[model samples]
Structures are given as structure tokens and as C-alpha cells.
Target: MNKIATIDTRLWQLGIMAILLLLGVLKRDFSLLPSQIALTFISGLLTQTLFIKFLNIKKYSFLSTIITCFGLCLLLRSANLWVHPVVAYLAIASKFTLRPFGKHLFNPANLGVILGISFFPETWITSGQWGADLTTALWLIAAGFFVARNAQRLDITAYFLMCYAGIFIIIRILWYGYPLAVFFHQFQNGALLLFAFFMISDPMTIPHKRIGRFIHAILVAVLAYIWQYWLYWNQGIIWGLFFATFLVPLWNILFLAPAYQWQPLSGDSNV
Candidate 1:
């Protein structure tokens, strides 16, 4: 019997994200022009290539760079063309420069989005851009499930979602006496689902051990809840993840596990 082939999880994620980007652009009006998207890919890949050559890394994998570009296309918005490429370049650059204990400190796409929004006021994420439609929410959840499952970090996604939802229920529905519809409305945000599944569930940035991942997920949920609800802030998940990243090294120290590699046994396994 011929053995079935396994697709690289990064490719699976890339395909899924590409579909999401197409849907966002076609149906949701994601506010990005084709030129901007093209520029982002060009700059990101070019930067990745330069880094690999400069650093003398033997393995050349563009999957992560493509994935990061897709993420930037989906989540980031800016009026200027330069903004996308600059952010993309910085995002890829962080992966090389920000390593500690043999691992990248921040999720590339997350870091890019956070930095874009922070440095340039015009660039921001539209959490509700996908709308409150149940159909859209279901579509994201289904696609995200496969990606998370393939990455073997579905547990982190589940824990984060459950904790985030639990906090929403207690604070908004029960304590504040908001209508059930309000809770459901918030639950159906496509951006929230995207963050939970794609961004936070990134194996490279997440804790290696199961227990550490669980704790990390819960911490992000609580911090995000407080940031969005109590502090009346926008892009709560992005900021929450940013601040929570400070604790990841600590978690790794407390509970050691092998660093994640996109492809095992490859010469260039780090990507």
C-alpha cells in the first residue's frame, strides 16, 4: 500500500489564510488595495531572502514569510502603500533579531500588526470588519479548527476561547445585565476567532509544554478581556498577546520542551 502523503502544516495554514484574505477582500471590503498586498509580499519575501543569505542559513523556507504576509493582508489596514511593506519587512526581521533561548520572542504577524498600529495612527485592525453574521463566524471557526488541529495547538485555542467567552458571559451578560443577543453578537466576531486560532495558536510563540500553554492561554484571555471590556481599548487581543509575550520565556524556563520547527529533520528547521 502506498503511504498517504502529509502536507506541511504551514502550507495548510497558508492555504486557509489565503482563502480568508480572498473572502475578506471580495465580500467584507478589507480596505486594502491589490498594490499594497503585492508590495507586502514583495518586501517580505525579499527581506527573508536577504536574511537567509546574510545569516548563512542553509535551509530556505518561504512558507513562514508567505504566512506572515497573508496575516498582514487579513488583519492590517493602512492608507499608505509604504506602511504595509515596511511593517512586513519589520515583522520578518523580528524573527531573526528577537531570538532568545533559541526561539523567536513574538509572533511575526502579531508583532507587525501591533507595531503598525502603535507607530502609525492610520494603520489599525478592524475587529468587527468581518461583521456579526453567524454564517461568517461559522466559516472562520471551521477553517480555523483545521489549521489549529494541524499545528497541534488546538488545546491552546480551545482554552483561550473558553476562558474569553466565560469572562464575557460573567462580565457582560450576567454582571452588567446585557441581553443575550449582545453576548451572541460579540461571540460572532470573525477577527476574534482569527486571533484565537491563527495568531495566538502559533506553535513557535506558544509554550512548548501542555501545562504552560494552558496557563498562557488563560492569561491572554483574562488580559484581553480586561483590556477590551474594562479599559475600553481596541485591538485587545493584539495588545494582550504583546504584553503576555513577556512571560513566555519564563514559562519555557519553568517547563522545558523542544522548540517548534516548521519542518522536522530539515537542514533549515527553524522556519
Candidate 2:
């Protein structure tokens, strides 16, 4: 592999997220406002800096902060400007405060999405913002595969997608006799793929061992299935991951493995 291929995966994640944000703004794929995006970044980065300074902590990179802000910009929208920054502040703080056994309990951005919708009436997620565009979905998958493969957490993404898809197929297609088009349409959803590849596959927040990851994936899929199909709620995958997070520490207790760390880049640029 080349230097780029061997580089830290967070860099890849940052690149992909930046691209998506740019596309969202330039192509009008989403309804993100410039002020909202600006405030989100400011709040998240400032929070990360305060924690690092106050705690005198090392072994940190701002890549995660940037990525979380991008996630907020992409997934969250608000009528009021203050909601973005408030959620960003809380989301970044969660990374510092919510560590269990040295790993953050929730993916910061995932928690941000949950907090935005649950607490703030002005904030909401428009899942269909990207539509069911085939080209966009393929682009996301191809880019996401590279990042996941580099992080060595592609297995989680695959397991989650497989479990989620199987449940969808069984319930929607076989049980309800929905057409194949409906199944295909559901699979093409950009939000679903984003949750699978980006949110659930965050190596830092999830279980450490393969078996634990496998079980986590299935549990999340089941919760998502139930939340969406049975309760008819939105952002089921986000909620599913949140609910499934309770068992992560148990799995870590049972299946011991090294906690993940972002690698130094090819040029040792991991400050």
C-alpha cells in the first residue's frame, strides 16, 4: 500500500466528511445554513480545546472534533441558530465526561443528533435530504468502505448492514409482500448507509472484540427495526445505537481487547 493508504484513517474520515458538507452546501442537497454550520464548528472545537487545556490531556487529535462538527452540519437542522451550538457544546463535552473504561460511551455526533431532536423543538433531521440518488449512494459507499477498511472496523459496518437489511427484507418484502422496488428503495437510503458506516462503525465507541461487535450490530439492527416499523419513529438507527450502547461495557468486560487508538499518519502527523 502507498503512504496515503497507510495513513491514519481519521484523515480519510475528515476528507470524506468535508466533501459531503461541501456538496450539501454547493449542490443544495440539504438545508444547512451557513451560520448554523459556522456555529457548530466553533462550539465543538472550542469545547475540545477547553477539555484538553483544563485536563492537561495529551493523546488527542482535533480530527474527531472536526468530524463531529461535520456530522452535525450534515444530519442536524434547526430553525433557531442557538440549537446547533448548544448541541455541539454538549456533544463535544460528552467525549470527555462519558468515558467508560477509557472509551467514549456514545459517538459524539450520534449523541448530538439524539439531543437535538429530543430536547430542542427547533432542531430536527430531514432524513430524505439526500434523496434516493443512486449515484450519491454509491459514492458514499465507495468512500466509506475505504475509511472503514483503514480503521479495521469494516466488520461492524458489514454486520450492522447485513442484520438491518435482513430484517427489512423479512418484514417488508416477505411478510408484507412489498415489491422489490420498495426493498431496493429502502436500501438506497443515504441516511441508513451513513448510520451504518459512520455512526455505528466508530471504532472508539463500540465493543472491542469481534463477537461483541457482532452482537452489538444485531442488537442495534433489531432496535432500529422495531423503532421504525413498529413505533413509526424517525431516526431509528440513531436511537437504536443509543439504546444498544448500554451493553457495550458489559461486552468489554467479557471480551477483552486493546482499546482502539488513531494511528500516526504516514508522516507522523498525528498531533
Task: Superpose all Cα atoms of candidate 2 onto the true structure and report the RMSD in Å to 1 decimal.
Answer: 2.0
Regions of model 2 farther than 4 Å from truth = 266-271
Question: Candidate 1: minimum summed lDDT over ten consecutive residues — where?
Answer: 1-10
Q: Each model's TM-score? A: 0.95, 0.95
Error of 2 at 250 (Å): 0.7
Output the lDDT of residue 255, model 1. Answer: 94
lDDT of 1 at 269: 57
lDDT of each: 0.86, 0.86
**Prediction 1 global C-alpha lDDT:** 0.86
C-alpha positional error of residue 54 in candidate 1 after TM-score superposition, expressed in Å: 0.2
Q: What would the per-residue lDDT of candidate 2 be over residues 6-103, giving only the tens digit for each residue?
A: 78787888898888889877985577788999999999999999988998876578888888898889899889999999999999999989876766
